[model samples]
Target chain A: MAELELSGVSKVYGAFNALRDVSLQIADGEFAVFVGPSGCGKSTLLRLIAGLDPVSGGRIAIGGNDMTARQAGQRPVAMVFQNYALYPHMSVFENIAFPLQMERRTKDDIKREVSRAAEIVQLSTRLQDRPAKLSGGQRQRVAIARAIVRKPGIFLMDEPLSNLDAALRMEMRAELTQLHRRLGSTMVYVTHDQLEAMTMADRIVVLNGGRVEQVGAPMELYHNPANLFVAGFIGSPPMNFAAARVDAVEGHAARLTVEGLGSFAVSYDGKEVSAGDAVTIGIRPEAMLPGAGEAGHLSFRMTPETVERLGLHTIVHAPVGAKTFTALFNGDPRMARGSALDVSVPLAQLHLFDRNGAGRSIRDIQ
Target chain B: MTFRSGAADAPAFNQNLGAYLFLAPALLILFLSLLLPAAATIGMSFTDISFLRPTNFVGLDNYLRLLSDGRFQQAVFNTSYYTLGVTLPTMVLGLLAAVALNRRFPFRVAFRTIFYLPVLTSLIAAAVVWVYIYEPYSGPMNGLLVSLGLPPQPWLQSPNLAMTALIIMAVWRDFGTAMIIYLAGLQDIPEEIYEAARLDGAGKFAILRRITVPMLSSVTFYLMIILIVQSFQVFGAIYVMTGGGPLGSTETIVFQMYQTAFGYTEFGYAAAMSTVLFFVILLFSIVGTKIMRKGEA
Candidate 1:
C-alpha cells in the first residue's frame, strides 16, 4: 500500500481543459472517490492516475516516486472498468490468472493465487466458466478478482457499477466496501453518483467543470459544503436557494429581505457584505419543519403542488413565489395539492451564499 | 429466416402447406443453382461426355485414372501450396493493418481507404495490374529489385518461382478483403478491455498475443476459411499471368478444369476435377466453422 499524490495535474484537449490544476494527496490505504456530474472530469482524473492517459501538465507520484512519464503498464496499479471488461474468451480462472501470467509467474503460483482471489469474490465454483456465462454482478466480481490477484499498490475503478441493475448496484456497493475493508489497499474510484461516493469514500473529491469544488468526508460535506455547487450537489432532493437582499448589517448579524418571502435576522462573521447587497439563502429540504411560527426561524407560506408519500416519509413539493422548494417531513401529513404549508427554515441550519456563488456561512452561524 | 406465423398449428397438414408454398420460389432457385449443378457434375464424372464423341458411361474409369494422373497430382500440389501460402500471409498482414488503423492517427482514414481499394477492384482488373507489376523487364517490381541490388529474374516464367509469384500476387489482391473484415471485428472490441489489460501489467506484445488474438479467434477462423476457400479456387490470376505456363507449374485445380472443359472440350473430366475441389473446400470450411463455434463456447 502506498500514498497517491497529484501535483497540479491538468489535462487539456485542444483548448478544452478536461481537468485543471488538480492537486490531491490520498494517504496509503485510503478509499478516495472522485465524484461529479457527467462532464465534471472525474473519470478523466482517474484515467490520468491509472496512467491510461497522460497529463497535459504537472506530475503524478505514487508511493513517493514520480510516475508522470510512466506508461500504463509500468504503473503499479490495477483497474476495474465500468463494463467489467473481462476477456470474454477466457474462463474466470484464466481472467483472474491474467496479471500473474503477465508477470510470468509459475504455474503452481498462478493457480494458488487465482483460487484464493476466486474464493474472496465467492466465484470459486464458476472458475472455469467464460465471462459470457456469468451474470453482471459475477462478471464484476471476476474483474475485482482480476485486480486483486495482481496485488497492485493502488486499485482504480472507473464507474464500475454503472452497468449493473439498480438492485445489483446496491449489492455490489456493499460488497466493494467490504472488499476495500478487507484488502486495506489504496483504491481510487470514480463515479457520477453522489450516493455511491457518500457511502464508499474515505474522502470524496467533488469536481465541477474540471476543477475541484470541495474535498471532505461525506457528512462533513453534507453538513458544511464549501460553495453553492457542493451545497447543491451533496444531499438528496438537494438544498433549496432563494434570492435575498441585505437590509442592514449590525455586528456579525445581517437583516435580510428574501424576495417573495419575508425579512429575517441572520448572523454572519464578515465585512464582505453591506446594505443592499444581493445573496442567496440556502436550506436543506429536511430542515423545513412543518407548521411554522418557531422563534428565530424564518417562516413562509407556500402552496403544495405535489406530494409524494414514500411510505416512511412525505416529500411535499411546494411553490413559494417564483421558485419551487422541496420540504421533506418525517410523517405523511395526508397533504393535498394547494394545501397550506407553513414551512419554517430553522435558523440553526441556514446556508448563506454570496452573489458569486461562494458560501458565506460566515464563520459558523450554527 | 425462421418464422412462426402459423406455428401454433404448424404440425397440421394444410397449415404446413402454406409454409411450403411460400418457400417454393427460394427452394426452386436453390435447386437450379446449387443442387442441380452439383448432381450434374457427379453424374457427368462417370461418363466421357465430349462434343466430338458419343456420351458413354465409363463407371470408375475416370476416378481410377485421376488417382494415377501425374499432371492432376501436380495441379493438386500447386493448388494446396498456393492456398496455404496466400491464406496465412494475407491473414497476418490484414490483422496487422487492421490493428494499426484501429488506433487514432493522422491520415488513418486515408490509409484505410487506400488498403481497401484493391478489394473494390475487379478480379480481372487486379490480375492485369499484377501482371504488369510482375513484368520481366522495366516493371516497377523489377526496377525496385534492381535498385536494391537484387536479381531481376523472370517472375512469371520460371517453373521454380511461378507458383510462388502467383500466390504473392493473390495475397496482395485479396488481403484488402481480410483487412476490412478484421477491421469490422476489431470495432466490436470495447476500448475498456485494453485499458484493463494495460493496468494488469500486460505489455504491448503480451496484449496483442494474449488479448487481441484470443479475443478475435472467431473472426480469424472465419477469415481463414474464406481465404482458404477462395484461394483453393484460384484461376483468374494464373490465366492472366501464367496461363499454366513454364511446364504446368502454376496450374491449380480450377485452372486445369478451365483448360479441360473449355480449352480441350473435355467437359466430363473438368466436372470430376470440380467435384473433387468442391469436396476439399467444403471439408476445410466445415472444420474451420467447428473450430470457431468451439472457441465461442
Candidate 2:
C-alpha cells in the first residue's frame, strides 16, 4: 500500500478552474473521502490523483514517487468509475481478469487472481455471467474486482456507489469499510453525499468552489467546521444560521444581540470584538432542546410550521425572524403547527462567525 | 354487465380499426411493389409466356434447363465472386473510416461529409464516371501507371480486368454506406467503455479488436447482409459500365436476367433467374436478422 500526496495541484479547463491549488496527503491504509457538493472539484481532485486527468499545475506523488506526468495505466493506482463501466460484452471472469490480461500475466495466474478478487467481493458464483445478466450491485462488484485484481498500491473510486439504491448503498459502504480494513490499502473516494462521507471516511476533505474548505475526521469536522461552507454542508438538516450583532465586549466575552431572540453573552478566545459588530451565529438542529431549560441558555420563541415525527425524534421547522429555524427533540413531543414554543440551546454549542463568513467561535479561535 | 361489456368492445374494435388505418398505406405499397412481383415471377417461372408466342404452362422445363445451363452457372459464380469481393473490403474500409471520423478534430464534420458523399451519388452517374476513369488509352488509371514507369494496360477492355475494375468501383461507391452504418453503431457504444479499456492498459489497436469489434458484431452482420443483397442485384453499374462486358466476364445474375428478358425476349427464363436470386437474398436476410436479434438478447 502507498500513501497519496498532492501538492499545490490545480486543474484548469479553458476559462473554468475545476480545481485550484488542492494539496492533501492520505496516510497509507487511510480511507480518505473527498466530499463536496456537485461541481465542487471533489471528483476532479480524485481524477487528478488517479492520473486520469492531468494537472495544470503542481505535483502528485504516490508512494513518494512523482506521478504527475504519468499515464493512468502507468501509475500504481486503480480506479472504479461512477457508473461501474463494466465491459458489456465480457463475462464477469473476463471483466475481473482484464487488468491481469493487460499485463500479459500467465493464464493460470490470471485465473487464480481473478477468482481470489471475485471471492473477496463475494461474486465467485457469477463468474461466467456477462455484465448484462447481473444486477447493479453485482456490476459494481465486478468493477471493484477488476480494480483489486491489479493489486495497485492505491485505489481511487469516483462516486462509485451513487448509482445504487439507498439500501444497496448502505450495504456497499459497510462492505467497503470492511474491505479497507482487510486490505489495509489507501483509498481516496469522492462523493457529494455528506452521510456517506460521515459514515465511511477516516478523514473527510470538504471542498467548495474548487478549493479545500476543511480536512478532519468525521466528528472533528462535525464539531469544529472551519468556515460557513463546511458548517452548512457537513450536517443533515444542516446547522441553523442567524444574524447577530455584538452589543458590547467585556474582556474575552462578547454580548451579542440577535433579532427576535434577545441578547446573550458568549465567551471567546482571541478574536477582537467591538460594540455593534455584525456577526453570524450557528446552532445545529439536534442541539436545540424543546423547552427554555434553565437560565444562561440562548432561548427563542418559534411558531412551528411543520413537524416531522420520525419515531425516535420529532423535528420541527419554524420561522424565527427572517430565517427558518429547525429543532430536533428526543422522542415525540406534542408539537403542533401554528403553535409558538420556546426552544433553547446551550451557549457552549453556539457557533459564531464574523461578517466575512469565517468561523469565530471558541473552537475555531483556539 | 352485458351492456358495459358491449360498450367496451366497441372502443376496442375502433382502436383496432384505427391502427389498421394507420398501417394501410405502407401495407398497400409493400403488396403492390414487392409481394405481387414475387408471386408473379414465381408463376411466370412455370410458363413459357414470352408475349411473342401463345402462353403455355412449361411446368419444370425452365428449372430443368437451368440445372444444365452453363451460362447461368457462370453468372452465378461471377455474382458470388463480386459479392465476396465487395462486401469484405467495403466493411473494412467503412469501419476504418468510421473509427477515424468518430474523434473530435478541426475538420471532423467536413471529413465525415466528404467520406459519405459517394453513398449519396446516383449509381448511374458514378458508373459513368468510373467507366471514363477506366477508359484505357486516355484514362487516369493508365496515366498513373505510365507515370510510375509501368506499361499502360487496358482496365475494362481486358476480360481478366473488367470484373475486377467493376468490383473496385462498386466498393468505392458502397463503402460509404457501410461507414455511415458503422458510425451509427459506434455512437451506440458508450464512451466509458473505451476509457475503461485505456485505464486497463489496452492500446489503440487492442481496444478496437477486443472491445469495439465484439461490441459491434451485430452491426457488422447487418451491414454484411445489406451489402450482399445489394451486390447480388448488381445490375445498374454492370449495365451502365460493362453491359456484361468483354467476353461476358462480368455477367452477374441480374445483368444476365436483364439481357435474357429484353434481348432474347426469354421472359420465362428471366423470371426463373429472378426467383432464385430473390430466395438467396431472403435466406441471407433471415439469417442476418436472427443473429442480430440473438446478439442483442
For A285-362, candidate 1 gives per-residue lDDT tens digits of 999888875788888888888999997888988877678889888887767888786778778789888885555444
Best by DockQ: 1
Query: Which consecutive 10 residues in model 2 chain B have the weakest lDDT in total?
Result: B1-10
Per-residue lDDT value at A309 in model 2: 92
**Local distance difference test values of all predictions, in order:** 0.89, 0.89
Tens digits of lDDT, candidate 2, B163-269: 99998998898888998999999999988788788788888888999899998899999999999999999999999888897898999999999999999999998
lDDT of 1 by residue, B129-245 (tens): 888888989778889999999999798889998888888888888888889998999899988898888888888899999888888889999999999899888888788888998
Q: Name the lDDT value of residue A251 in candidate 1.
A: 89
lDDT of 2 by residue, A259-350 (tens): 77888898876465678888888989998998876775888789999999999999999988789988888999887999899899988788
Interface RMSD, all candidates in order, equals 0.9, 1.1
Q: How many residue pairs collide in each prediction? A: 0, 0
What DockQ, between 0 and 1, does each candidate earn?
0.76, 0.68
